[model samples]
Every structure is written in structure tokens, then in C-alpha cells.
Target: MQMLQLSAEAYWGVIAHAQAAVPLEACGLLAAVQGKDLVSEFFPMRNAAESAQLYRLDDAEYLQVEQIADARKLRLVAVMHSHTHTTAYPSPTDVRDASAFDPFGALLYVIVSLKHVDPVLRCYRIVGGQISEVSVEVQW
Candidate 1:
């Protein structure tokens, strides 16, 4: 299986962002060294959809984050979002919206579900409308 190595700070950042979103789904970007699977940074963004069930990264925020990543010599490797009332799995909407969403081809998708007391995070790769689980390797 494919693996996504995430820094502990980045992991917590994602979780905190998700928790802050509360009723609405949270969303963010993961940055890594070009062509690498290691996530070195997390960039939290406002959920444009503003819905409890779904998330949409604001286009302006996305561009700003992209520029920040580029300046840091990192490339955006994945998109992370939270599911407030559902499991940490991609929804039909996610599958449909993810295809060709990244100009750099398919992107890793990290979903955090706050449906339970302990949040569950899952990784996936959605390419050509197919969803495949990816192993998440947390790095301290």
C-alpha cells in the first residue's frame, strides 16, 4: 500500500483545525518536498461550502497556500479535510470533485472523522474517480 508520512505537528494541526470547524467541515493543504510522500507542513483553510457534511477549499486561500508552499520549496502533496458526522472516508461528492482537481495529477486525500469521541483519520488516493486507501505513517 502507498504510505503518507506526516509530522506530528502537522497531524495535530489538522486535527485542531477540524475541531475548530465544529459544525462545518474543516479543510486544509499538506505540503512536502517535491515528489516526496512526507508531509512537512499543514495549511488550514476556510471551508467555502460552510456545510456540516462537506468541505470546499476557498479558491483564494488555495492560491495563497500554493504560493506559500512554492516559496518554501515544497509542493502541495495532499488535501486534508474533516467529516463531522460521518466516517473518515471519501463521499460520492469527494470522488467526483477530486478527479483532475490537482494540476499535478492525482493527490493524496486525508480525511478526519469526528463522529466518535476519538477522531479517526484516513488517507486515500482518488485518481480517475477510483478511491484507494493509503497507509498513514505518523512521524514524531
Candidate 2:
């Protein structure tokens, strides 16, 4: 199984952002130095869709964040979003939207489900409309 590494701070930051979004879905990017699966930074973003069941990264913020990551020598390793009332698994909409990503880039898709009392985070690789789960390692 493929694995993605994240510092405890980065991992918690994602969960916190999800909680903070409350009734709306939260979205963000996880960055890493080029060529590494270990995430080094987290960029929480405003949800353009502003819906409890969906999320869309603000286009302007996406571009700005991309530029910022480029300047910092970081590559966005994953796109993350919160599912305000569902499972951590990707939905059909997610698979369809993931087609917008480069098939060869190996980018990760992370979903944080807020259906239960505890937050549930799951990582996935969506390529050619196929969904495969990836393991997440929260390292201290």
C-alpha cells in the first residue's frame, strides 16, 4: 500500500480546520519539498462552494497558494477537503472531479469526514477514475 507521511502538527491542523469550518466544508493543500511523500506544510483555504456537502478551493486562493508553494520550493502533495456529514470515502463527485488532475502526477486526495463525534481522515489515489486508498502515517 502507498503511504503518506505527515507531522503530528500538520495532521492535527487538517482536523482542526475541518472542525472550524463547522456547517460548511473545509478545503486545503498539503505541501512537501519536491520528490517527497512526507508533508511539511498545510494551507487551509476558504471553500468557494460554501456548502456542507461539497467543497471547492477558491480559484484565486488556489493560484496564490500555488505561487507561494513554488516560491518556497514546495510541491502540493495532496488536496484535502472535509465531508461535513459523510464517510471518509470519496464520492462519485470526487472521482469525477479528480479526473481534472494529472493522471501521472500521483497526487493524493484526502477526505476528512465529520459525521461522527471524532473526525476521520482518509487518503486516496484517484487515477483514471479508479479509487485506491492510501495509508496515512502521522509522525511526531
Candidate 3:
């Protein structure tokens, strides 16, 4: 099984962004030291889709974030987004989008679900159209 380690700050940053974007999906990028699985930074990004059920990282924003990560010597670990009315599972659209965007299956996809009273965060790896859950470890 795969695992993603996140710093406490990064964990809360994701939740805060998700809640703040309520009604519309929020998206962001996760970064960590090169070749490591522990995430040390979260880059909140504008959702180009701007829809409650869909999300797209703006092209310019994506490039900017990539540059920042490169300068910091960090790897782009994953792409995160929120689901306002669903569980913390990848939707069909998510699967399709992942395949289209990440053909090499390099980045993990993290989903934050706000359907219930409590928020749920789940990580996944979508490769070759197959979706598999990845465990997340929140470090203090």
C-alpha cells in the first residue's frame, strides 16, 4: 500500500482551503523535498472550472506553482481538490481527468469531502484508468 505523509500545517491548509471554497471546488498543489513522500508545502490554487462539481487548475497558475517548486528543490507530490456533495472518493470525471492530465501516473490525487458534518480526506493514485486508495499520515 502507498502512503502520503503530510505536515500538520499542510493538512490544515487543505481543510481551510476546502471549507473556504464551499459550494465551489477548491484545488491546490502539494510539494515536498525531491524524491520524498512527506509533503511540506501546500499551494492553494484557483479553480479554473469554478463549478461546484468540477475543478481545473489554471494553466498560468500551474506553471507558476511548478516554477516555485522547482526553485525550492521540491517535487510536486500531488494535486488536491474538494468535493462538496460527495464522499472522499474519486468521481468518474476525476478518473478521466487524471488520465488526461497525468498520463505517466506520477502524481497522487487527494480529495477532501465536505458532504457530512465532518470533513474526510482521502488520497488516491489513478493509473491506467484504475483507482487505488493511498493511506495518508498527518505528522505533528
Candidate 4:
């Protein structure tokens, strides 16, 4: 499995928090140094799901991403979320939402599976709603 430069501590922290938000859904965005391969910032979003139907990031969240990129001198490299009862891979709804929503096709989609024994984190690039895996360097 591939890994992202995200700090293990931070990643696990977010995972635990996300998993705790179970049954509904959790969402967040990641800010990292442009091409540096390390996550430097994390922005969590509130789950606005109405019975398993998740809402896309609203305007405020989108604006916040731009601000973080500017302030941290990093690009909005990835968008992350947790899967409550499924695999780490994107679901049909996820793909559909990514196609119609994700602003930058350049950003990676990171999915964390809270249902497994050890949480599973997977990253992908969504192009026209087609997800392609992207590898990163991470340590155990």
C-alpha cells in the first residue's frame, strides 16, 4: 500500500475523531506544501447528511480552502472523508459527487475506512468521476 507524507500522528488523530463521528459521516480537507508530499494543515467539516445523503462542501468551506492554501503556502492537495460501513474505496455516491463537485481535478481524494480493524486510508485522483490511485511516501 502507498502512503502520503501526512504525519502519522495527525492522520491517526483525525481518523479516531472521524470514526467517533460514526453512523452519520465525516468530511474534511487537507492542506499541504505544494509538491512537498507532507500534510501541514487539516480542516474538518461538519456532516450535513440527511439520511446517508451527504452534502458537498458549501461556499464557506470552499473559500476556507483557498485561504488555507494562501496562508500556508501550500495547495489544496486533497479532500478527505470517512466511510462508516464500507471499504476505503470510493462508493458510487462518492464518485458521483466527486464528478459533479470537486473543484480542482488536481486535488487528491483520500478515503479513510473506519469500519475495518485498523483504519484504511486510500488516496485517488478523480477525473471525470473516474478514480485513479495515487501513491505517496509514508512511514508505518
* Top lDDT hit: 3
lDDT tens string, model 2, 30-131? Answer: 999887768979999999998987788899999999999999999988999999888999999888778775566368998999999999999999988898
Tens-digit per-residue lDDT, 68-109, candidate 4: 678878777678888877787888888888877764576778
Per-candidate TM equals 0.94, 0.94, 0.97, 0.82
Clashing pairs in 4: 3-136
Shift in Å, residue 67, candidate 2? 0.9
How many residue pairs clash in model 3? 0
Candidate models: Cα lDDT each: 0.89, 0.90, 0.95, 0.72
lDDT of 1 by residue, 1-140 (tens): 27989999999999999999999999999988887777989999999999998888999999999898888889887899999989999999998878857533357999999999899999999877778899999998
C-alpha RMSD of candidate 3: 1.0
By TM-score rank, best first, the candidates go 3, 2, 1, 4
lDDT of each residue in 1-140, candidate 3, tens digit only? 27999999999999999999989999999999987778999999999999999999999999999999999999999999999999999999999999999988899999999999899999999998999899999999
